[model samples]
Target: MSIKSALAKPFAKIIYKKVQKWANNPVDTQKKVFEELIAQGASTAFGQDHDFVSINNHSDFVKRVPVRDYEALKPYVERVVAGEPDVLWKGKPLYFAKTSGTTSGAKYIPLTKESMPNHVEAARNAILLYINETGNAKFVDGKMIFLQGSPELKEQNGIQLGRLSGIVAHYVPKYLQKNRMPSWETNCIDDWETKVDAVVEETLPENMTVISGIPSWVQMYFEKIQQKTGKAVGDVFKNFNLFIFGGVNYEPYRAKFENLIGRKVDSIELYPASEGFFAYQDKQNERGMLLLLNSGIFYEFIKADEFFTENPKRLTIKDVEVGVNYVMIISSNAGLWGYNLGDTIQFTSTKPYRVIVSGRIKHFISAFGEHVIGKEVEQAMQEATEGTDIRVSEFTVAPQITPEEGLPYHEWFIEFENEPQDFSALAKKLDNSLQKQNSYYYDLIVGKVLQPLKINSVKKGGFQAYMKSQGKLGGQNKIPRLSNDRKIVEGIPQ
Candidate 1:
């Protein structure tokens, strides 16, 4: 091992001990974070609005603050965007982690001076814990590549705004700067395909040992390397041993990746979002990522099935049980109050609090774990027929898990008031629109794991007929806009 890896080994041990102290007392650690959040919140506009001064404990908090999605939280976020200070948290956010939303065009999640370190530290600790456990730090000395968005940031008022990964690029620990690749110029390339091309050019000859990104994008990188060198990626970068990824499960693409690399390498899974860096894989052999209890975020859980029900029971960490699906809610120091994070997760272990991402709370199709949600399909459908005379009558989308021909696809059963001039062109529009909105779907499409979506023209009254058959069809009942399986689609009149 070189000097950097040699030094990281001892440092890794110190981090492990510190992490264990909190992990072992999960509930108490969460309580401390909650108290800190409430104490700090008492000084803010939101705290005054919600009567946070009267909140004595968890029960009081739940009563004072109801759960809210981005739309509900927009009022405060708007005030912050307009240069207001202390509207949500103690002060104006240092940066806004911009993300795409369903109803809202763009969302600006706050990163306060206090909460920003949680994201960077959680990522670093994940690697260090691995080093401490396996006695493997050799990868630290070689080149590391994080495939991500353009680091170019825009300023609003006095606060910087960018994609979470782009904002994170500015905060890469000083120690890793020498090992990290490709150059900043390549990282700032805006277009995905163009950036991948530039990254390959810069990284091909380096002593690359660690690669990080969403699995689909990283697969693109692997494929590009093979095309250039006509060799497996592992052979091309003999020292590459670590694959760090988040956002989507790697299982569906594992075989394809291993085939591309010619061998399996150690992998670490992280559960991160624009809202917060929530969890990371602390143990290699573990079933789930360890929930971050001490990261200045207090978490709540509501049973997924009951989330739509009025006044569903909100659960604290101590009340969470293994194997039950729950919508993870959070109140963080970042100024978000009782925010609905849109993720559904199942706890795998309660003692140290570990969870596996299950799916989104409402209208999600994850047959291949791509997490195609209702909003994405709606946006795509709207975009596809925006200026065209062709109008939609009724429609629903479902995953085609096993097609008789080649790879799988999202099957669109659409009833058109006026059909497209060319059916194939319309399908392409739908496919392109969906891919543009969702990065995971884009990756799947480009990686050849899923084909471009296919649209089946439904008989004009098909949706109504299906809805009638299923129920006492009336004003209240309607055809689901999207389903993961073909149950609803199969029943539609052909």
Candidate 2:
């Protein structure tokens, strides 16, 4: 092993033990984080306004602080942005993670001194855990690239503000600086397509071993490399073995990725957001990511089915069950309290507190009351296309409430890399898979309230054209797997 790989083995073990201490005591770990957060929050203006001093337990917290999304909490965030101290947390935030969401405008999530380390450490620990689990530290010795937003940041209220990945870029460990690919200038090239082209050129001659990014963007890179080198990515970088990805599920892109690489590469999934880094895949072979119970954030869950109803009951680590879709709520050291993350997750293992992000709570189709979630649709797609040569490039689902003829149906806009032999048969198989996963959808189809879902073939690059039109063409921007409204997919040609 190279010097770096040799050193990584022992270091990874230490992190594994540290992570295990919290994982083994999941409930207590979270409770302690909760207690510490409440204590710090008591000093903030929001805490004082919400009676945080009186809150001694989760029940008290629940009664005092109701869940609030960005809009509901905007007033306090506005104050913080205008340079107010002791407003949200104990002091002014160290930085603001600027994110694009909520119709109002950009959301500036606080990243305090106390909370920033968790973001850096959680990502570090994920790789360390992988090394410890599989004894695969050799990849650390080779050039690694994380396709991310520009490291360039802007100033806001004397605090740095930028994309989360950009902020995190400043923290890349010194040991890996030489190994990380795509020079700073290439990364700073604001245009994603241009940056990727630059990345392809910069990485082409290196001994690249690890590649990381959202799957869609990475696929673009892979295609670019293939076009220039006229070789499978594996041939271009024979040592490349690990693909670390986040922001979306990888299964849908698995076949296409394997095809691009010309072989399967091990992958690690992470659940990260502008608010906080929550979970990461800790094992080479596992169903879900290891939730960071001992991180600065404390988690809460409410069943997705009842999330829209009056006062949905919140459950802590002690109460969640496997396989149930629950909307994830969080309180964190970043000074966000009772914050609705709007992401739905399902616990795959409660003992070690592992979770898989199922979907965004808002990104689902229930116009016909079937409540088909991202997870269900993804699962259906995976099952339907299994054991087939059909490869999907990108896809999204929207309800077609009005059709030119016949009953209205759910429209699936698919950009296929390799189309199936029979589109009609594929549609039936997809419908069957979805029916097996959701009874309400099954009932709707049986009742003839909705016709069988129809698949619309989107010509190659159609989705890319649509995303580029919206100015969301890369770097953590991805079309939703499904939407309640047709706004997102409306621009797509079908």
Best by lDDT: 2
Candidates' lDDT values, in order? 0.85, 0.92
Per-model TM-score, in order, reads: 0.77, 0.99
Q: State the weakest 10-residue window (summed lDDT) of model 2.
A: 98-107
What tens-digit string does per-residue lDDT give for candidate 2 at 122-168?
Answer: 99999999999999998998999999998899998788989999899
Q: What is the Cα root-mean-square deviation between model 1 and the actual structure?
A: 12.9
Model 1 weakest 10-residue run by lDDT: 471-480
Deviation from native of the Cα of residue 426 in model 1, angstroms: 29
Clashing pairs for predicted structure model 2, backbone only:
none
Model 1 stretches with alpha carbons more than 4 Å out: 365-494
- What is candidate 1's lDDT per residue for 340-361, written digit by digit as tens? 9988888999878999886677
**Residue pairs in clash, model 1:** none
Positional deviation of residue 163's Cα in model 2 after best superposition, in angstroms: 0.6
In terms of TM-score, how similar is model 2 to the real structure? 0.99
